[model samples]
Target chain A: MRITLIGSGNVATHLGAAFKNAGHQIVQVYSPNLQNAALLAYHIKAEAIDDLQQINPNTEAFIISVKDDVIEGIAQQLAAHDKLILHTSGSTDISVLLKYNVKAGVFYPLQTFSRTKELNFWNVPLCLEGANENIFKIITELAQTVSNNVYPVNSAQRRVLHLAAVFACNFPNYLYSIAQGLLADNHLEFDMLKPLILETADKVQQQLPAAVQTGPAVRNDETTMNRHLEMLQNQPMLQQIYQLLSQGIIKMDKGTNGKA
Target chain B: MRITLIGSGNVATHLGAAFKNAGHQIVQVYSPNLQNAALLAYHIKAEAIDDLQQINPNTEAFIISVKDDVIEGIAQQLAAHDKLILHTSGSTDISVLLKYNVKAGVFYPLQTFSRTKELNFWNVPLCLEGANENIFKIITELAQTVSNNVYPVNSAQRRVLHLAAVFACNFPNYLYSIAQGLLADNHLEFDMLKPLILETADKVQQQLPAAVQTGPAVRNDETTMNRHLEMLQNQPMLQQIYQLLSQGIIKMDKGTNGKA
Candidate 1:
C-alpha cells in the first residue's frame, strides 16, 4: 500500500518506519512544521511536505496521526481525496472521519509510543475500524503488515479501551512517579521498588489482578494501613489516593465474593 | 545456619524453600495450624510444630514471618532465647525485637509473595536491619545466601520503602483491576491492555516515571479527560480516582518544572 502519513509525532515516526520496513511505500510525510516532516520522511525514505495541498495524490491511504483535537481539521483538508483516510487515535470517533471522507476508517494501536524509545511494532495490538467492509479489509491488511495482534473494534469499544488504557497505563505510571517521589524524600534509590513493580506486572500476565492483589488493603490489615496513612499525612494528596485505592480494592473483593 | 520459621504462610513457605536451596538448615516450620506447618515442613525437610513452646532450642536463628500485629507477641514468646531473632516485615521496627531478644534484626524481602507462584528469590531485594553490627553481619550473610540484592536499611527507611511499595505495586495493581472491570463491562478482553501495562512498567526500569508520563492528564487534554469522566459517571468512586490521579500527575509535572 502506498501511504501518506499526516503529522510527524511519535505515532507517525514509529508507524512510518514500520510501514516502510513491512515493504509498504510511504509516499509522503506531512506536518504543519516542515522540519519535523522532513526529519521523519528522511528516515522513512519519503517526500516531506508542509502544506496539506502538497499531499501525494498517488497514495492509496492517508493516516492522520495528529492530536485528537486537530484530527478533524486534518481530515477535512483530505476530504477531497478519494483514497482511504484513517486516523490513529484511540478516543476520536470514526464518524469524525466519516463526516469528511467516504473511505474513512480507524487504525488505532493500543500501546503507548515514545519518540526516544524503540518499539517492537509487531507485538502492538492494532484496533482497526472501517466505514465499510472493503475499507476495513484494507486497513486490516495494512495493519497485519506491521503487527501480529489486530482486532476489529468499533468507535464505542475503542473509547472504552482509551479510558481503560488511562487506568491501566497512565494512572499507574503516575502512581509509580508518586512512589519515586516518596523514595527520593527518604534518601532511598528508586531501584529498590523495581523488582516489586516488575513482579506485580508479571503476576497479571498469568492471573487476574484481583486474585493476585497483595498488601495491607487486601489483607484488611488496618494497623499497617494506618501507619502508612500517618506517614503520608504531610502529603495530603498521596494520603487521599492511598485511602481511595484501598477502599476500591476492598469493595471490588466484596463484589467478586458476592457474585461467587 | 539452622533457622526455625515462625509462620507457615506465603512468606514462610517461599523463604523456607529458598533457605533450603541456599544450603541453610530449616530446623522447624511453625504455625497455629499443624496441617499448614506440616505441609511447608514436609517440603523443606523440617519438623512441623504448632505450639510455640515446641520450638527447637538448637536453632541458630528464629525467623518470625507472621502478621505485623502478632510479631511482638511471637517475639515475646521467643525472647528467652539468646540466639538471633529476625522478623520478615517491612513496616515493623527492629525495636519490637530489641525489646525482647538480645540478638534481634529484620529480614525483609521487598517482593509480593503468593503461595501458588514460584518466585526467583535470587532477584528479590532483601532489606536487613540489625540491632548491632555483629547481628547485622549475621543477618546479611543469611540474606546473601538466598538473594543477590541485599541492603542494610534502617527502620524509618524500611517503613518508607513499604509505603512506596504500596504506591508502586499494590495501588497500580488495583488500578489494573479497575481497567479489567471496565473492559469486561464493555465486552472487551483484558488481554488488550496487557501490552500497554507491560510497556508502562518496562519504561520505569531505565527512566524516571515522571519523565515518561503519558496520556490526556499529562498532555493537559481536558477534552478527552472530560469524555472519560462522563463515561465513568455511573461509578462515582472511579470518577473520583480519575480526578485525583490526574490532578496528581499535573501537579507533579508542575513541581518538576518549577525545580528545573
Candidate 2:
C-alpha cells in the first residue's frame, strides 16, 4: 500500500519509518518546516513537500500525523482528495474528517513516540475508527501491517483513552521530573531512584495497581505523610500534588475495602 | 558475620535471603508469628524463634526489619544485648536506635520489597547511618557484603530520599492505578498502556525528565486539558489530580523557560 505522511513530528517520523519497514511505500512526507519534512522523507525514501499543494494526488492513503488542532485545517485543504484520508490523533472526532474528505478514518496509535528512539510498532495498540465500514476495513488492514493489537475504538472511547494516557504517561513523567528536582536540590543523583522507578512499573504488569501500591498514602501512615508534607512546605505545587495524590490513594483503598 | 533477623515481613525476608546468599550466616529468624518466622528461617537455614528472649546473644548483628512504628519497641527489647543492632526504615531517625542500644545503626535499603519476588540486592542502594563512626564503618562493611551501592546518609538526607521515593515510585504507581481504573471503566485493557509507561520511564534514564516531558499540559494546550477534566467529572479525586498535575506541569515548563 502507498502512504503519504502529513507532519514530521515524533509520531510522523516514527510511523513513516514503521510503514516503510512493513513493506508499504511512503510516497511523501509533509511538514510546515522544509528541513523536518526533508529529513523524514530521506529516512523513509519518500518525497519531501512543505506545501499541501505539492502532495501527490495518486497516493493510496494520506496519513495526517499532525497536531490535533491543525488536523481539521489540513483536512480542509485536502477536502478535494478522492483517496483515503486519515489523521493520527486520539482526542479528535472522526466526524471532523467526514465532510472534508470522501474516505476518512482515524488511525490513532496508542503509544508515546520519540523521534530518535525506534519503537516496536508490533506491540503498540492501533485504535482505528472510520466514517463507514469500508473505510474501517481499509484502515484496519493498513494498521494490521504494523501492529497485531488493533481495535475499532469510537471517538468517545478514544477521548477516554487519551485522558487515561495523560494520567499514565504524561503526569507520571512530570512526577519523575519533580522527583529528580527534589533529589538534585539535596545534592543527590537522580539515578539512585531509577531501579525503584522501574520496579514500580514492573509490579503493575502482574498485580492490580491498587493491590501492589505501597507507601505512606496506602498504608495510612499519617506520621510519614505529615513529615513529607512538612518537607515540601516551600514547594507549594509538589506539596499539593503529594497531598491530593495521597488522599486519592487513601480513598481508593477505602473503596476497595468496601468503606466510605 | 553472623546475623539474626528480627522480622519476617517483606523487607526482612528479602534481606535475610540476600544476606545469607552473600556468605553471612543467618543465626536466627524472629517474628511474633511463628509461621512467618519459620517460613523465612527455612529459606535461610536459620532457627525460627517467636520470642525476643530466645534471640542468640552470640549473633554478631541483629537486623530489626519490621514496620517503622515497631522499630523503636524492637530496639528497646534488644537493648540488653551488646551486639550491633540495626533497623531497616527510611523515615525513622537513627537517633531512635541510639538511646535504646550501645551499638545502634541504620541499614535501610531504598527499594520496594515484595516477599514473593526475588530481588537482586546488588543493585538496591543500601542507606546506612550509625550512632558513631565505628558503628558506621561496621554497618557499611556488612552492607557491602550484599550491595555495592552503599551510602553513609544521615537521618535528614535519608528522610528526603524517602520522600523522593514516594514521588518517583509510590505516586507513579498510584497514577498507573488511576489510568488502569479509567481503562477498565471503558472496557479497555491496562496492557494497552504498558509500552507507553515503560518508555516514559526509560526516557528519564538518559534525559532530564523536564526536557523530555510531552503532553497537553506541557504544550499549554488548554483545549485538551479541559476536555480531559470534563471526561473525569464524575471522579472528583481524579479530577483534582488532573487539574493539579496539569497546572504543575505548565508551571514547570514556564519555570524552565525563565518565565515568572
Candidate 3:
C-alpha cells in the first residue's frame, strides 16, 4: 500500500521508516520544518515537502502523524484532498478531521517512540477508528501491517486506554525514578534496584497484580511504613507518593478481606 | 562453603534450593513448623530440625531468614550457641545478632522473594556487615558463592536500599494493579498492557527515567489530566494515586527546567 507520511517528529520518522522496511512505499513526507521532512523522506526513499500545498493529490491516504493540537489544523489545511486521511493519535477524535472533504480515521500506534531506538512494531496495540467502514478497514489493515494487535477503538475507549497507559507506563516508571532519587541521595547506584524492578513486572504476567501485592502496605505493617516515610523527609513529592500509594494498598487490602 | 538454612519461609525455601542447585551444601534447615522445615530440607538434602535447640553448631554460618519482627527473637534463640551467624534482612540491624555470644553479621538479599517462584540466586544482591573486619570477609565469601553483587552495607545503608526496593517493586506493582483494575472495569484484558509495560521498563535501562517520563503529567495538559481524574472518581484510592503522581511529575518537570 502506498502511504504519505505526515510530520517528521519521533513517531512519524520511526513509523515511516518501519513502514518502508515492511515493504510499503512511503510516497511523501511532510513537516513544517523542511529540513526534518527532507531528512526523514531521504531515509525512507520518499519526496520531502516543506509546505502542505506540496502534498500529492493522487496519494490514496495521508497519515497525519503530527502533534495532537496541530492535528485538526493540518486536516483543515488538507481539506481540498479527496483521499482517505487518518491522524495517528491515542487521544484525539476522528472528528478532528471532519472539516476535510476527505474521509478520516485514527491510526494510533500505542507504544512509546524514541528517535534513536528502533522498536519492534509487532504486538504494539493499534487503536484505529474511521468515519466509515471502508476507511476503518484501510486504517486497520495499515496498523496490522506493523502490529500483531489491532483494535477498532473509538475516541472514548482510546482515551481510557491512554489513561491506563499513564497508570501502567508513566506512573510506574516515575516511581522507579523516585526509587533512583532515594538511592542517589544516599550515594548509591540505581542499578541496585534493576533486578527487583524487572521481577515486579514479570510477576503480573503469571497472576493479577492485585492478587500478588506485597510489602508493608498490603501487610499493614504500619511500623515499616512509618520508617519509610521518616526516611523520605527531604523529598516531599516522593513522600506524598509513598503516603498515597500506601493508603491505596491498605484500602485494597481491606477490600480483599471483605471489610470495605 | 557449608550453609545452614534457618527459617524455611519464602526467602529461605527459595534461597536454600537455589544454593543446592548451585552445588553448595545446605547442611541443616530450621523452622518452627516441621512441615516447612522438612519441605525445604527435602529439596536440599539437608536435615530438618523443629527446634533451634537441635541446630547443628558445626556449620561455618547460619542464615536466619525469618520475618522482620522475629529476627531478634530468632537471634535470641540462637544466642545460646557459639558459632558465626547472619540474619538475612534489609532493614534489621547487624547489632541485633551481636546480642548473641558469637560471631554475627547480616546477609541481606536485596530482592523480593516469593515461595512459588524459583529465582536465579546469582542475581540477588547480598549486603553483608559484621562486628569486625575478619567476620565481614567470611560473610562476603559466603554471599559471593550464591550472588554476584555483595556490599558491606551497615544497618543504615541497608535501610535506604530497602526503602528504595519499596518504591521500585511494591509501589509500581500497586500502580500496575490500579491499571489492571481500570482496564477490568472496561472488560479489557490486562494482557493488552504487557507490551507497553515491558517497553517502559526497557527504556529506563539506558536512559534516566526522569528524562523519559511522558504523559499528561509531564506535558501538564490540564484538560487530559482533569478528564482522567473525572474518569477515576469511582476509584477513590486510585484517584488519589493519579493526583499525587501527576502533581509529583509536574514538580519533577519544573526541577529539570531550573524553574523551582
Task: Report the first chain's TM-score for all candidates.
Answer: 0.96, 0.96, 0.92
Selected candidate, larger DockQ, 1 vs 3: 1
Q: What is the lDDT of residue A199 in candidate 3?
A: 79
Model 1 lDDT tens row, A70-101? 98988888989888899999999999988874
Q: For every candidate, what share of the true interface contacts is present?
A: 0.78, 0.69, 0.63
| lDDT of each residue in B17-123, candidate 2, tens digit only | 89989999999999999999999999999999999989888899999988899988888888889889998999999888887756989899999988866778898
TM accuracy, model 1: 0.96
User: Which residue pairs overlap in candidate 2's backbone?
Assistant: none
| TM-score for the B chain of model 2 | 0.95
TM-score attained by model 2: 0.95
Which pairs clash in model 1? none
Tell me the lDDT of model 3 at A143: 79
The per-residue C-alpha lDDT of model 1 at residue A52 equals: 92
Give model 3's docking category: medium
lDDT of each: 0.90, 0.86, 0.81
CA shift at B177, candidate 1, in angstroms?
0.7
RMSD (CA, Å), each prediction: 2.0, 2.3, 2.6
